[model samples]
Target: MANYFRDYADLCFEAFGDRVKHWITFSDPRAHAQAWHSYNSTWRGKQRGLVGISLNCDWGEPMDISSPKDIEAAERYLQFCLGWFANPIYAGDYPQVMKDRIGKKSAEQGLDMSRLPVFSLQEKSYIKGTSDFLGLGHFTTRYITERNYPSRQGPSYHNDRDLVELVDPNWPDLGSTWPQSVPWGFRRLLHFAQTQYGNPPIYVTENGASQKLHCTQLCDEWRIQYLKGYINEMLKEPLLSHMQMVTEIVVPTVCTLCILISAVLLMLLLQSQS
Candidate 1:
């Protein structure tokens, strides 16, 4: 990941800023802000519109809805996931709370030289408000339950958060293990993003459904139905008004009747030619 970050920076400059408009630097923001900012001028005034990182956000809700600890845990999990990216793009720093949690261990892990990479005063100032818009990739909502510290994951940030995911089978399943279609959760996630990042304009970079289906009669009626239903649910959320739905590559199914008719036509044509 670290090497990829540096390479993206080099390539961004090499492209001379003419070919690229929106740049998403994929790396730990705190650790690589300098390299990223260095490319800003390299592409400036080249019709290049915006530059920012793509973030994967978990929209979390509590599993034990009545448990205060679970509620808090849910909140923390969202903050940890979303805030990690938003803090740098908006606030120009790591979420202060998160730093206090995992910054030390990361330091001892040979990141001591620069556990959370430092941004020069100018770099931080430049990086603040660098986002054209926050791009969020959200799929499903997980029900978070607070748990005791994980069993020896070696001081990782996620481990420190102590969030265990509990899924509900009741949430309409479009047929993936990870994503149970919780339409309301999508709304809640948008609301949280708006409130947390001061309502930065958001673009849904990716959202879609998947079904583990096997061909029995060679009909994909189930897949088509899943798309129709999920899309209906997605459209209900006003925040997703601007969102776009892209159906994955679907191989067209051959109709049995059509195939039979074509075969008969072929036989008739062959007979006439003979």
Candidate 2:
């Protein structure tokens, strides 16, 4: 599978390298690092511009910030989500917590080895520092708590983490199936990325709230508020001064949705001053 993807990427780069300046080998390479690793080692030198990957995560906060278990669970959730991908790009391997827990659980389940694939030292070296910039797509937040799910049910992604996710009822709902407008999560997510990836140049590849389908309303006040709240959090003091940040709002193609453009511009102006 990795070889196939590498071949395809080579073709694209050779065919359109002149026109396409930036090339992303994969959107999220957590589950499949081999392909991106191959690109980094083989095709990266050939490309004229930057090569990177985009990662999507909702920031996880501990249910009990003071409790060690809860804090571990929250960190575990991050290791499972963003760290699952970012660690390889930055640290050149999976998070240590993931390896320890998964390895232990796999042994108890009568498995000889962990389900999570291990990278060779050479491969790890290739993957590390592969990304020129980190692309982040963030929305919503979840309260995480320690929950020891039994591995007897079978080895699965959710059970492996042993955590429970909850959402605050007070958070504003934007009529989506999931994802409430929790602006603080945006700041926390950015901070986590900065700390974990050594403050790599970050681009907010996707950030916005989803509205109900088939709603022909032109005045998307909910979206505007969501954008304002989240962008304002990003522009807060200490954080803004510390990291180089760029936000790109993912807007829908509806012709009547002119309010989104105006709201984004206004927020950008506000962000600049802060």
Candidate 3:
């Protein structure tokens, strides 16, 4: 993958430029610039459509917010997670604090570079405004604080980012174990993305809830409610639109067979009565 990242820019530029209107590059603009700066720098002059990366974002709120520190901590948490990814695409560097924080910890973790990634001057210049659209893939939300922030020793990606953890108190605990239903957080997250990232065209690659119990008698009212809230929040602005939802459900084979047998039995009973 490293070798591919190092070399594929020229190949992709030649092969894809003709048909590709817009290109979604990499999650790291620094790395993206190093790879495609040559292609993108002149591609614009040649009338080629621009490229950008799809950043993964988890938008959420703080669980404990009574203290002022908690509020600031929450903001910092979100900024480090989502903003750290978006800032380089627009501002051309990882947040200064993040760089410093990671730098201090890298020695202990045996990291080669600040796990945050590096940006070259050419790459920075090339990556800025490279995104024709800001592709964001948001799945769930997390509550955060400074105390909750973990060091590089922690296993989870968020922990490595130095963010404390939390969950929405009121969010429903259906579908998946990790995702709580904080539909309001989705709206807040979108607004943050708009305000922070120049309101670039946002394409939401994934957004949906998980499944609960599987039975005809079991109502999916919870999922329906979650959908209503999330969709309303996303559709608030006419211009902010993106992917169509593709829902995949696994209907049990036993359930299908049971329905077929029930239909056949009902028909036989009705014919005998007639």
Which predicted model would earn the best lDDT?
A: 2
TM-scores for every predicted model: 0.66, 0.79, 0.66
The lDDT for every candidate, in the order shown, is 0.67, 0.80, 0.68
What TM-score, to 2 decimals, does candidate 3 have? 0.66
> How far is 245's C-alpha from truth in model 3 (Å)?
31
How much lDDT does candidate 3 score?
0.68
Give stretches of model 2 more than 4 Å off: 30-47, 148-152, 213-216, 237-274
lDDT for model 1 comes to 0.67
- The better-scoring model by TM-score among 2 and 3 is 2
Compared with the true structure, what per-residue lDDT tens digits does model 3 show for residues 113-135? 76667888886776566566777
- Model 1 clash pairs are none
lDDT of 1 by residue, 45-157 (tens): 55555766667775799988899999988887886888877876688776776666566557656565534556678866866777766777777778899886644676666
Candidate 2 lDDT at 69 equals 97
* Residue 59 shift from truth in candidate 1, angstroms: 1.1
